[model samples]
Target: PDFKPLPKTNQSVGIDLGITDFAILSDGRKVDNQRFTTKMEQKLKREQRKLSRRYEQAKKDNRDVRECKNYQKQRMKVARLHERVAFQREDFLNKRSTELIRHYDPICIENLNAKGMLKNHKLAKAIRDVSWSMFIEKLMYKAKWYGRNIVKIDRFYPSSQLCYVCGHRDGKKSLEIREWTCPACHTPLDRDVNASRNILAEGLRLFETTQP
Candidate 1:
């Protein structure tokens, strides 16, 4: 049998979490948005409607409803729909996270303030679907199991606003501005990538300065 030691590096990968871009790796790698929940929402809703209708009919029939085979069949159908959606979402996340773990040696990602973000009513559903917390939890343990490191940077760091090329800070680029040309370096920026790069650079600097 042959065994090999993992590579030791003085570098790390940073990631930015979002809905438009599922993940942006610090080294300018873009992982496409795999909106598993968003894609299944419509179908799930339709199934829920069918389930609700069955429940309503059962209610109307009262004591006699429990004996009906059709009601029992519809109940099982609805349960299967829910099971399918859960599997789809779990499968997508597992695949994406596994790919990242395989590609990067040391991964760093922002410690997301999930509760704070949920306060924004408009983003609530989208945030819930992205499941940032779950992703981080899985990634952290996987990295440990594979002899890789997962670093959680502070949430307050301005990954998106800082120019990765020139370190220029621009306060004007808000959440609405998805893509922008950097004012300092004249480089085109994909918002997520720019943020991810900044995160990676900052993490490297932090790792060096703190000797972590």
Candidate 2:
């Protein structure tokens, strides 16, 4: 299966991965992020609370928690919820990566510093829920299996801040500034769209450097 090379195509895509959506592709496509954790959080907390209460009750009764039926049953229920979330995320990533591999050549994405991003307490939960690192790993492994290429542009490339239409660095933008017009060309830009285009350009540049 790994031996079959992908069909030659003139397509190269840059993807901007984010918490709000799965990815923003350079080809004007947006894949919505599956917020699995957020969807299951309430249910998980309920199950966990039940398990905790059972543990506390067992302790109060001077009973061995291992020998307690309620404690054990609640524990298993909570465990299954966690497993469901994990499986759902994996399934989504696998399908998305496979589709991308089949279509695009030399996919480009940011070399994001997830660890550093997580340090922001306000955004930590959102960042953790998206699982960027895991998604990238899945995309990469599938790319190798199918004999495709992936490019990781430098983390500090400023994909969002720079104008894709005219090589102009407008300035740093806050997360809230989702849309802006380029000062140089007066070209209207959607933040993610411009970033995707820039990513595609960078990925293609990197690919050329590796070729004989």
Candidate 3:
């Protein structure tokens, strides 16, 4: 995969990431989250239950657990289920990152504190399932591999609170509030999309200032 280059383009885009939708783009596009873990949770639980029951039955029957055919079969079933989830996640991230790299000259995204975000127990599973860190890592290397640029806005930048219309920085709002009217510009904004646009603008500004 070395030395591969893509066609040149001056277009750029910014992305806002979320658990509901994998990404929302500055260009008004939404990449719906696959929610692989959520989708297959029931199936996985069933597989896990099968594995557990097999182990218990083996123990109760005084059989060597390792040599029990049923136990081994169920364990492999559970393991394969886990493997499937992992493979699906990687596949989705790869395709998503590749699409962005191919279509946009420069890709912009917020610098998220992933570890800090994971501290919220309620959000931990969903956040880890979405795997924002892994997605960004793929984007970084893929951008370089495909001759595209990738930019990250400062973690401190208030992308969500800033009004894309008039550069107004509004007071912080709770995550529950998805849509709001920007006070300064009276702009009706979808939180994620607005953030994406602001990220794009900020990223462009950074690139412009640094250019020769």
Candidate 4:
């Protein structure tokens, strides 16, 4: 199919990506994290255990594991479980990316260091399940296909730390601190929403400077 640019809209958005919520928009809308992998984890584990038992049974029977019909069948079941999870996650990412491109002219987001983030063992699994890198890739390609712009703010930007209302540079806040009142402006803020707004502001600023 020949791809055509979508009709332009005045709408622009900044997105903050997180594990709690898949994405938080500057407009205060949140896309809930589906946790596809986690949801399927138990079933997958059971199937894998069954596959292992089948393999062990094959070994005891003096049959090649690869040649054992029961082992192969169980292996395929485990493989299908993994495939289902991957497909679900990919479908979700594709839909969200396309929806954003269709509605927004210039989408802004923070340049996340996903690899560095995965270094935290406690967060690695959750982060992988969210598949931030894959989502960003989809957004980038879809933006190009749909004639939308993707603006990425610097990774080093203190988006979550700064107050979006008064631009006060508050010190680091832990992940548990989801909401706070701005010390400078006394305005209440949702951490993710505030970060998104900051990203939008910074992205637009950068976009303006880059324009001829």
Identify the candidate with maximal TM-score.
Answer: 4
- Per-residue accuracy of model 4 over 2-93 as CA lDDT, tens digit each: 67999989998999999999999999999999999999999998999999898888888888988888888888889999999999999999
Candidate 2 structure quality by residue, lDDT tens digits, 1-212: 53577786767899998878779999889999889999999999998988989999999999999999999988989999999999998888888988898998889999999999999999899888888899899888888877888999999898998899997998898999999999999999999989999988888998899999
Steric clash pairs (candidate 3)? none
Off by over 4 Å in 1: 1-11, 64-68, 210-212
Best candidate according to lDDT: 4
- Over 79-141, each residue of candidate 3 has an lDDT whose tens digit, in order, gives 898999999999999999888988997788999999999999999999999999999999999
Candidate ranking under TM-score, highest first, comes to 4, 2, 3, 1
Instruction: Assess the local accuracy of residue 165 in candidate 2 as a C-alpha lDDT between 0 and 100.
Output: 92
State the C-alpha lDDT per candidate. 0.79, 0.90, 0.91, 0.93
Poorly placed runs, candidate 4 (over 4 Å)? none
Q: What is the alpha-carbon lDDT of model 2 when measured against the actual structure? A: 0.90
In model 2, which residue pairs have backbone atoms overlapping below 3 Å?
22-33
Per-model TM values vs. the true structure: 0.87, 0.96, 0.95, 0.97
Least well predicted 10-residue stretch by lDDT in candidate 2:
1-10
Which residue pairs overlap in candidate 4's backbone? none
State residue 134's C-alpha deviation in candidate 2, in Å: 1.1
Worst 10 residues of 3 by lDDT: 1-10
